[model samples]
Target: MNFAFTEEQQMFRDMFADFVAKEVEPLAEHISEHEEIPKALLKKAAMQGFLGALLPEEYGGAALDMVSYILLLEEVAKSDMSTAMVLHVHNDLVSRAILLCGSAEQKEQWLPAMAEGSVIGAWAFAEPDPAGLTNLQVMARAADDGYVLHGTKTWVSNAGIAGLMVVFAQAPEGPTALLVPADAAGLKLGQRDKTLGMRGVQIHPVYFNDVAVPADAVLGRPGDAQAVMAAVGDFSRLAMAAIALGGAEHALSLGVDFAKERKQFGVEIARKGAIQAYIADSAVEVETLRSQVYRCASLADQGLLDGLSASIAKLWANRVSYQVANRMIQTHGGYGYILDYAIGRVFRDCRTVEGIEGSNRTQQAAIARSVLAAHGFVM
Candidate 1:
């Protein structure tokens, strides 16, 4: 695979970076303090075709290659992770699912609206169980014309603002996905959670009491939940890895800049060995993570992304995110603990990388299972 980005990809990266610098970075603090991203910013991103970054042109999408999409997310994340995550769910998790698994009629119904940013998409997959995709508690009861969904989804990102949601529930055939309009009758949003990081995200518990939908609302075939999830999860994880890479790079830059400017004992801290070591370690991880993230992105573009590779990239990126952020805080000393500093916010936001998509343990389990299976250790 070519490590270097194509000319078009670089141009896209430049555009993304410039947009984020002018629009996103200035608002990062405000969004965190207010716990909400302004609708105007999202509209601007949609205008840039970021909301439809990976969709086909026929549906009003940008039709960008996966590498370019990764670059877009990476640039946005460098300025604000909340905005990046909002786009991630909209593009990678929900709209991409429809593009990949929805029937042509379904795509025709939703894709244009989604691309135009008239409707924002959300994914509702978790339940009381933290990892609810595999251990689903929601049930989809068969009805005369369609299905009636019952139960609640927890920690649903973009719940408050999503116009559409792809809700996962168990059907008679097996686990199934149903696209439900957010304003459907009997659907309710519980109070939003006050999270430690990514506070700008509007995560809530979504309750469904016999929420009914037509049979055509089903995404992909019945009993094909595993396949659909595998496809979506790989893409989402790769996107998360890109976000992590950009965030880590920003944190490392913060530390390096601080070290050069801060003075202790009549000299700059950058001259200290400990500070030098901290920056050195973080720089190495950031570079290594960059390679992994881009390679996986390229693989995705070539339609060769595998579960194991995606999991590995996500797990490693999660580690790098936390480590780099923590090191930045240490480099900041007492100033890091102060909320007035951007490092504190970055540290809090970076912590969510491990918990989202899948936890570190979740990634480890998947990796171990793959390795053991390859070694003929069958269950």
Candidate 2:
């Protein structure tokens, strides 16, 4: 398959890189320490259409193809994983769902504001049970006028700041997807989660206490949560894999620069065989991951992306990122443990993506299932 980026894609990558280098990289340390992305930086990103990278042009979006969209996320990740995740949740999980499943009226009502970034989107799916859709604790009871939602959604990304949320809950008919405004009465956001990394993501537990939404608030059809979630999950895994790839590349660069400057004995550490091997191994893995990420994006564009491919890419990316980050830390020696070093942050951020869309165990199970099915082994 052709992996070469088109001229347009290259141009988009350059634009994204320029923006991240100027506005994101400089603030990466500040964001991690403050546990917040500056509102001004987010607004500037919105103005550049990065927030609307996947929506159609009619809705004021860039309408980027999947590869170009991947490029955007990858570039942002090289600077700040937190900002990349914000864009990922907005475009991949929330806006894309609205564009794909919402009725024309729903689209008209939400898409433009979402594209313009006046309305940011968040996903509310994970619950305490962690069994996924089949065992969602959140319930949407049908009422004469509409539905009243009751339950708590945990680990909601972009929680407090999101203008809109796509929540999944159990209905009488089974699992269902609904659109709820963040300001709806009885919808409360808990204190922000103090995560191990990716501090700027703004995750929180969302409480829905007798929250009411119109009958039309259902996304797509009732009892269609499984299908909607599966689609969104596949794309999110791929997007996350791209993020891991970018983070790995950035870590490698930092390690290489340090090794070249760090003096050992009478010469630089770059002259050492061990340092050379670390750099070479990391470079190889980074290139391999780049291929996997772009191939999956191309598959998505061709409507040929499958659960197996996405799972593999995500699992591999997570593994490679963590490994590369660890090796780079070793290369940095004591400096790697210091907060002043960028590798420390990169290492922390790499750990967080492993559990974002689907945990490493989740991906492993998915890969096993696919393999067994292919081998004609029925569970």
Candidate 3:
């Protein structure tokens, strides 16, 4: 089967690459050092149609296909993973959830603004529970006319900056999601989290204390939160895998360039057997990840729900990213560990993929369950 991108897709990828090189790469060092997300950069991305890549055209989005979205994600990730993450959270998790589950009016109200970047969306799901099973905990209770939300969401990206949030909470009926206004009363945005990687995307804790939202705030039916979350989870895992693949590809490219230029014992490092082996191994890993990501994306685009494939791609891609980045760092020796070098930041960023969007261990269990079910195994 032909795996090459279409002409239009190629053009889209090139355009995104140019945008990242011109707008994001220059600010990467400053963002990493200060842990600041450049709001203007996000606005620029919105204006350029990057924020709405997957939304329908009626909602002001380009409504590009999933492969095109993946291409754009990869290009953005290659420059600044943090900035790429901001777009990913907005597009894949928040906006996609609304599109997939919200009522028609809800879509009309939120999708256009979200696509225009006037309303940024954040996903609030992760918590500090050691078990990491916050989905089963009821944090908000539905009242007669509205819901009283009470809970704390940790590691929430764009918590303070986003205009809207899709908060997963437990309701009296069951697990549910509420679309909360960022400026809602009784809602608090905690101080920025100091993470080792993806610093340009602000991570914060969100506290909802007696925050009231109308009945219409519910996304889909009550007790359908798990379904909505599962869909989001699948898309997010695959998208994150694509991002990791992009980072690994970037790391490989840099390693190759550096090896070709750096000389040792009066010969270029690229010519050495060890360096050559490292490059070869990294290339293999990156290519494999690319294939897995594309296959997952294709399946999603076709409306084929393959949780197993999504988990496999996410698990493998995350591990491959860490391996590729670590090897690249080793190849660069002392220089790779320094802040001045981009590999150091990429290395840290790569580590985050395995943990976020569900950990590799979680993916493994999910995959195992899928295998058992296919084989008619009953627990």
Candidate 4:
């Protein structure tokens, strides 16, 4: 029940904070404005073990625990949710996917480059169809050598720059996940999508037009959707929590700073009752989410957390983050709404985290399912 971070974890947090202060914060606007992550920063982040925090030391990765990874994600997201989104995709969705479900052979083949940042990865879990099917819609038919993939995935984060992608598909064996290289023949990327937020992070609809890959490309046992999803859901939810918490904390900090500096009636806004209440609420909310995040992350590190816990953490944190960010913007008065200030970006960025890793609505359904199962309901 001790939620205090270990001294080592605190030190790691401080180190990452320094890195973010110097490298990431300066480039947040640049990335958000251009929808691009600088190549050099990517290299530096890899060197800092962000890209492959879960990979074992044998593969040139830091092999960080779930708690430490959460800390890193939180610090980075505070500066730029877009860059944070990219890191989460590469680390949690891609690298972590392989480590959790990847075959030993597959790990050997790809984990090194992934850990070194020489290769970036994406995980495509959604379909492009208008019907909104959550299941893998891409079809992979067995060919003479391996398989031919035919389908498209929309709003795939990290697709634009990913050197490799873990694509889920309907294979002959059933729902399967394949490790498809970016340059595979017949693979086509749709135009970069103009997203409302996270515009700096490239996303698109990826088309697998008879894209082919060898049998070894399979990440794990094909058709074991339950196994793959069980692993994916937990970390995805935790990662989203980290992203949201970071934004919330940063927005709250921004509001506090602005309050102290802005004055009305010859008194600092910090002394005003209304502005102080906003800060008070935001401060409390940030701590509340922080407690949930660390508690769940600790449980995950101990292997005591279930998918239900992850979903609940994400559901609550995402909602709270938006609330906190919105309040901070309100506290800033007219200045917050302007693009020149960072709070406006934080407002939009938090909204995007709410939708990803399955939307807040999706998490509600998942949490309900868990409740039913706990209550002895069976299908």
TM-scores for candidates 1 onward, in order: 0.98, 0.98, 0.96, 0.96
In order of listing, the candidates' clash counts read 0, 0, 0, 1
Name model 2 segments beyond 4 Å from true. Answer: none
Clashes in model 1: which pairs? Answer: none
The TM-score, computed over Cα atoms with residue i paired to residue i, of candidate 3 is: 0.96
Which of candidates 3 and 4 is the stronger one according to lDDT?
4
| Candidate 3, superposed: residue stretches over 4 Å from native | 130-135
Better of 2 and 4 by TM-score: 2
Error of 3 at 242 (Å): 0.8
User: How would you encode candidate 4's per-residue C-alpha lDDT over 267-342 as one tens digit per residue?
Assistant: 9989989988988888888888888888888998898878888888899888888999899899899999799999
Q: Per-residue CA lDDT of candidate 1, range 305-337, in tens?
A: 998999999999999999999999999999989
- In candidate 4, what residue range of length 10 has the lowest lDDT sum? 128-137
**Over 4 Å off, model 4:** 130-135
Q: Rate the local accuracy (lDDT) of all candidates.
A: 0.91, 0.91, 0.85, 0.86
Residue 187 error, candidate 3, Å: 0.5
Pairs of residues clashing in candidate 4:
35-200
